[model samples]
Target: MDVDTDIDKHFQQLQDQKRMLLMAKSRKGEVPRDRKPPQVAYHQFMMSHMFRAGLAQSNENMIRSAFVPPAYQPCTTPIMKLQPIKINQLQLETHHRGRYIVLKVMTPPMRMTGILALGADANGDIVLLHMYNQEEENVREATDIVDVGMIVLVKEPYYKLTASKDYALRVDHLSDMVRLNEDDTMIPPQWMSRISEIHDSFEPHKAKADASMKKEKWWKAIRDYTAAIELGPPPDRLEIIKRNRALAYLKTKQYDAALADTGWPGFGPQPAEKALFRAAEALYHLRRFSESVAVLETLHATFPDNAQATFNLERAQKRHTEEETGCYDFKALQREAEHICPPHLDHATYIGPIKMKETAYKGRGLFVTKRVKAGDLLLCEKAFALAYVPERDEERSAGNGDITLLINIETEKGFMGGQADLIRIIAQKMYLNPSVAPAFTSLYHGDYGATPITFVDGNPVVDTFLIERTMALNVFGCPNSSLATHKRAMNNESMVDNVYHSCGIWPQASLINHSCTCSARRSFIGDMMVVRATRDLEPGDEVTFWYQIPHFKANMRDKLKGWGFVCDCALCQDAKQTKATVKKERTKLRAALTEKCNSPVPSHKAMERLIDKLEATYAVSPDLVPRLGHWDAQMQVARIYAAKGNMDQAFKSACKVLVFLGFSLDDSKKGFEIKKWGMVLDYLIDAFMFIGSALIELKALASAKKAYQYAKTVYRIVVGEDETFEKTYEDHVF
Candidate 1:
């Protein structure tokens, strides 16, 4: 949770300037309530920290990362006494331990992003409490977050001095606070006031909601319906109103709210046909396809001729099977991504042969359950929550692509704009489906440690800041892929892309560790993360993917510092052992080779000599260590030789591309055979493609066909599935 002191100083200067402006306004007898400050894109990750002091001067920080406080932990003593803790009696710089204090909000939150409220305890003693690392409160979007008149419990409240040099009780963690229903027994007699007029207006509110529904104002109808329900209507009327609200919730795409009203287990069972149908629809949208199928089956059986049920049942069955197996329609996935704002899709998640287990100093990682070959499916997982911002040519410069921002008030760092939206969406999802919280919280959040979710008033308490930290570490930058755009989009990032149009949290895939010479390769089909093995592996072999493929000149450790781990992969180890003299020699040879290849009068002999010099810098043979930089040089020389119609040298240089990558080959009369598989990369497919072309030029059709077969195996592994391999890669001959 360390922050930049400079950012903190900048925040203080901004605060002083704000006070001066407010004072000048007061002098003019025109004071503004809730005055805001200007925020610029600086010191908010991209390097600088967000700092401890408030920089949230504008309304932009509002309405993000709002979440429910955790459930109250009851005292375990056999005889517990109820005593009111006086907030006024609390002293600054003191941690008041061993007391559960009840309090009621007395004012609207004065600050946002990180919220603060002036409240009175059960003893009627008023004090200020600031919720650190939180979002806006009392917003209509998520009313359960916090609002005036809401009762809460503060555990062992720390009465401390904040950065503002003001006294307030600081609630740093969600575990330290618990929201309670107004009817809780601990609520003081003075705080037990309810409006009789509002309570009796249920009928009128329901009528207004019906009118709104007719006008197609779904959100308005939802608000009216919520107001009506909270007013305490009779059971029969309440059920009718809830059902109406459930439809509105569905229209608004609030599946969790719809499910809650669809007679979920906690709510009394409705058992009616429409209720069952609505419940199934909610489950369907939530991607609990198996549950959806079960519900739809029951409805279809009783309502035999229901066409909607029949159609949905078929779809649910297909989706459920897709989740169970890794089969998916990749073409359809691309089609969906083409839309600017696509619907929440069930590309169907399938966890294949991999199992998550703890590793040595690596912490946790995914491992293969059985011996598997390259092209074998490891996992095909849909994102838990995906935020995709279509590239708008007018908004951001082209190639910078889209960005997602997530700000952590605790750590005081900002991630990106899209990330902020994603964090809010995830918080709301967890709020709706409590079961999902455990899976989300289980992901790595570096040294932030773990905090379990607790339910309050039947609603799961989700920590928003924990989500910020977890996502900052685990979120993957997903770039859209299309067969139309690039035949082998998997290989098109020069085997590594730093730019992405979207990002998402894929829970199962996040468990895999990083390696430069990783065991598996990942490709995106819309929001679906498809992983396949890069090389053959034994049972219990760890599956790893490149977080970012390191370049020869790049400082790998510095680049991946945010990820909080140094890669100890074979390639990284080899790079470390490589001497400075070798690197200098490789650089000099690469320049000469590039000059020879790109010259108006290109010299084939000079390029070949320089390529040989580059390849020789490697301490070990190509069979043991990867000559990564040499392969590109060899490919360049091979291309020139092929154009000159010198098939002999083209074939040799083409074959050397595979050799430099640690693969041994045999082209005896027995035909083209890969004697051993070493480090595998998508570029090897290109190498074989070059080899195939060279063979065809040499009139060895049989050998060319054999080379193509090798290319197809590499293609399957690179693409992550064989379903569309032949169609996508119709021609593999260079």
Candidate 2:
């Protein structure tokens, strides 16, 4: 006995610990670290056990029962089946010191459970039931048990009922008692007084109320019913009386009262589905789309496949989108402008946050009422919104020929003419790569400028969406007419420019005015373009980034010229003289290198000499060689040589020009370099995999397995999951 006691105590301690662990996990705050691992394992083990036991299956009947009234149907599933028995009268008892209504009932042999329940037998003996604890092994043997023909008693308490589902029941404990033997001898003075007062009231008043209700004078009839309820017992017919009263209340537009009466104890306690729908409808009527969405979202979470909830949710979400883009309040704009723009145009000031105002037509790009900085991210649009046309088969077949390129150009111009200028704007700044060229190559004619168009009043309205890309230039003041343009312009300059551009950023460019000798410059980085103050200007001074620079490399100058505006900018004015002088110097360097290559020096000695001269010239003017054509051509040749293991030539070629091509070293070979590196990485990843597979094919299991592991590590890094290197360390090392 002592040993058994000790064992039971140990088991109880383990069980208590497990319960504590479960409680900790279910708590709102973080669990203690020492407890977490064990809890996780326990939870996973339990889940697996339950899954194997088929315990995870949905209890469809329980779910239905939650929404349905109990009296409306039998216990929904076999799990809740009640045993049937027969009885008659019930005795009710409670220790609570309050006035309560006793409902007499016969306790049947069936198992009845509920704190407050209305139970009925086939013989029409309706009982207000509660749990009765009889202290005997068998109910038949218990002296307190109510046998057949004995009435069970129950108490009804008064409380104001509300609309929510949770408050439907009136019970303090699950095990409150009821007995089938009616104790009429124990009727209290309050019960007798209630019965006496009810019986003493006017029957004519009730007849009059019933007549008014039949005539559809609902409000008055309800008033009469209230008086009658106090005068006598509630109409003996539960369903018919309740339904008639509910209809009368509804006819009087007393929805609250109708809902209340319907949700009373004897009636179905509110139609949950209809209540949810009504809530959604009310929220929509109030123009509270987010609230409507929230209600529908809650419904969907509880009932995911509910068609009405899904439909309402979609409607609300769509309304939200429309509201954001359909209407532009100019008053709101004026107020924001006053807040964001500086008081004086003379001083650099904070132009407030500018976002798109609603446009009248499709393809209307970003619009801002307040001033914006040069490098600010006006908006980051997904590609789908941008206007584009598919590349034609003929264009694709042109195999990089001029005619195919020309066809691409025509298609782009046609779309722009039809009011989609996104392609044209992009083409002005980006030199089309082979990958994107087919789609947008012909979009920009030599004369086309970078402007977004919106259709207003049946006419095309062009607006400047971003600051024009600018390179080397001195700043100057802008025309007053062009103030809006200058405020939102993005100066397109490479990283090497004193400006900074990050794709998703915009800074002081919002404040800067256009100038040939601007004190500030901006640069682009992916989606961010940043304008850093290169030179300070006095208050009210217009900030400007140079629209053009003369001494910039060949492709840079060409791109600016393509904007079709004359080079009245300072850079263009001086670049002609600068270019001639640079050309003469470059010619002299080339002659020296060629003569050295032809001379009878040892091959290694000659190569060393060439390296020194090239490095010096490249350091002095890296753009010299690549100025004659596209910079990418030179870089591509270098990459090809690198791939073939001609490391000397590849390194020399890349070093000669690619390094100094852009403002920041990071930006110099960005777009093209990403593509180039991607190719090389792909090859290396494949090679590792191939080597592993080859070993496996040859049945060299040990080597094959090791190679496979190494290959996986390489793949992981390529996919940007470098931490995986440590995960498979053993496989690679072995």
lDDT by residue for model 2 over 1-734, one digit each (tens)?
00000123234434444444344335323212221233453344345445533531442111000010111100111111222232222111212222233333233332211122343333453433333212212212322233334333322321111112111123321112233211243343343343432324535446666898777666556655555555555444433344455556555434444444543322233334544544555455434567667767766786787887798888776655534443222233323323431111111112223333333331111234444332232221112112111123342233311110001111111111101122222322122111222222222223335333222222222211111122101112111111122222313222222221101112223223233434344432111222333322333334344444323243334645433434333334444445665555655654654565456542434444544443453323332221322223334444555556664455444433333332112222111111111111212333334444444444455655554554443333232222333442333332
Query: Each model's TM-score, in the order given?
Result: 0.73, 0.24
lDDT (Cα, tens digit) per residue for candidate 1, span 1-734: 01111234235444554454344334332222221111221112112222312333321322223222222232221112434566655655555556667778755554433566666676555666777544333233323344577788776676654444345667755555766544456667666666233435788789988998998877678877888888898888888888889898887667888888878643455376777788888888888899999989888988988899899899989889888987777657656755535334566798888898899978899999998887678898888987664433343443233233333333545445456556666776676566566677878546654444365444456666567668777888765543322463445534223455456788998898887767888877667778888778888999998787656666677767777888887667777887888778878877777777789867767877877778767767877667766677678778889989898888877777778777788754236677777666756667777788888888888888888877777766665445565666666534
Output candidate 2 Cα RMSD. 31.8
Predicted model with the maximum lDDT? 1
- CA lDDT of every candidate: 0.66, 0.33
Using TM-score, give the best candidate's number.
Answer: 1
Superposing all C-alpha atoms, what RMSD in Å does each candidate have to the true structure?
8.6, 31.8
User: Residue 189 deviation, candidate 1, in Å?
Assistant: 11
Give stretches of model 1 more than 4 Å off: 1-196, 200-270, 340-344, 392-413, 445-453, 482-497, 667-670, 678-685, 709-734
Worst 10-residue stretch by lDDT in candidate 1? 37-46
